[model samples]
Target: MGWLDRLLGRRRPRPIPPPLWQQTVARLPFLQWLPAADLARLQSLSEAFLAAKQFSGAAGLEVDDAMGVHIAAQGCLPILNLGLEWYDDWVEIIVYPDEFVVPRQEMDPDGVVHEYDEVAAGQAWDGGPLILSWQDSQMAGDGYNVVIHEFAHKLDMINGAPDGLPPLHPGMDREAWVAALDGAYDDFLARVERAEARGEEALEQLPIDPYGAEHPGEFFAVVSESFFEQPQVVAAEYPALYAQLALFYRQDPLARAQAAGSSRSR
Candidate 1:
């Protein structure tokens, strides 16, 4: 527990009310595969999250308990096994009604400066608040999850700047992690380049989101979203990276999804 938590009277989190939890879990299809024990832990985590962080509505979006719980659930998922301590750095979440634009300035190699607006579904800052679009927040299924993408950035920023790499655990091999992610990232970029050369249709059919190839940090966030939402895709396309992620997350989403499939079939 941090001094801030104690000061704010948020050190001990109460359990999520059963009714709110039921409604939240029911609305979020992606959380259906979590084990019962894990779900219980997630409830506690959500409570802690709601207590520790402040949520603000933007652009006239009303932030309510249900909405807050939903966000908290998604935010807590990535850190379910990792623990809430990983997210101790930040304290606020700002949600817009839809996609928001932020002005950005970039300097060219020739020293020319360009300024423009970049539309974004979500953004995470180092030791700062997380910004998200409520429209994007409600669009999770198949492979898109704004909450996961932004929180994944939080994980990446734990050590320093947003690179694809997060702090490795004791048993995890850094060299192996580097080799796996780097090789997969290179291969993905080559695949995207080929797809672009072929056509738009080919680009759409690519195994994972091409946005991942944008940068190592984006790759980590994009793939993390895919890993949880569509683990089969990650397992099929980037088996090595998927394996490393499974090792890091300490959860086998592929196997869980397969089990769910079998249960539904029977």
Candidate 2:
């Protein structure tokens, strides 16, 4: 219902892309280091996302204007370079004031124990509704943001399988992504187990985020949070992982954080 859109007799934008300023805001922290051209591209994509979707906070948390801005800002964060196109498949976003415990009952492999645990907030079903708890929306200790973690899962689900992999762009090798992530996943598991065994208080520390070792899928999601929020930590601690993610995401967030750090010192 825009003037130029009306002039062209267009209806509903026909999935037109987002604009540069929007993308920049979506990648707020990363914007500190993006080159002008790349920043503009991100901005454009964000613009299109705002134009295309209707965001609403659910439950007791009213989706007010400020809430809309916050949710849109975080929702689009995962797709800054990728654009908001992947998110088009889903329509609704539900937000809770704090972590919503999701209960699940599953049978173990041996078929003996039925176990259940209350886990933090999460996104669910493909293109369904992205569930989040604003309490953990901000950076947690070691910089784990639940909003980013769950949203990353949704992005991975774009290709119809949340196997810890999202659709890669052309010229990128799928096998490389697999190998790199697989190696890092194994290493992290071993490291965590060893730390627990040795009872090394310092060894018990997590490189990216301890939650990352929960599973391959969780590893990917957790690492992604570090890649964006605390890239320097991710890079210094997991260099190879950082490099591979750089190839996959087509962005150097760690470098960006370093640059931003340098500027802050001045």
TM-score list, all predictions: 0.93, 0.78
lDDT by residue for model 2 (1-266), tens:
44223312422333223442344255345444665676555545544555565555556675543444445555566677676667878766677887766766777788876757686766666778888776666443246667678878887888876777788778877888788788888988888887778776745466666677788888889898888778877787777778877876767877766776787799
TM-score of decoy 1: 0.93
RMSD of every candidate to native, in Å, equals 3.7, 5.4
lDDT of 2 at 170: 84
Whole-model lDDT values for every prediction = 0.87, 0.67
Instruction: Give residue 233's error in model 2 in angstroms.
Output: 2.2
Among these predictions, the greatest TM-score belongs to: 1
Model 2 TM-score?
Answer: 0.78
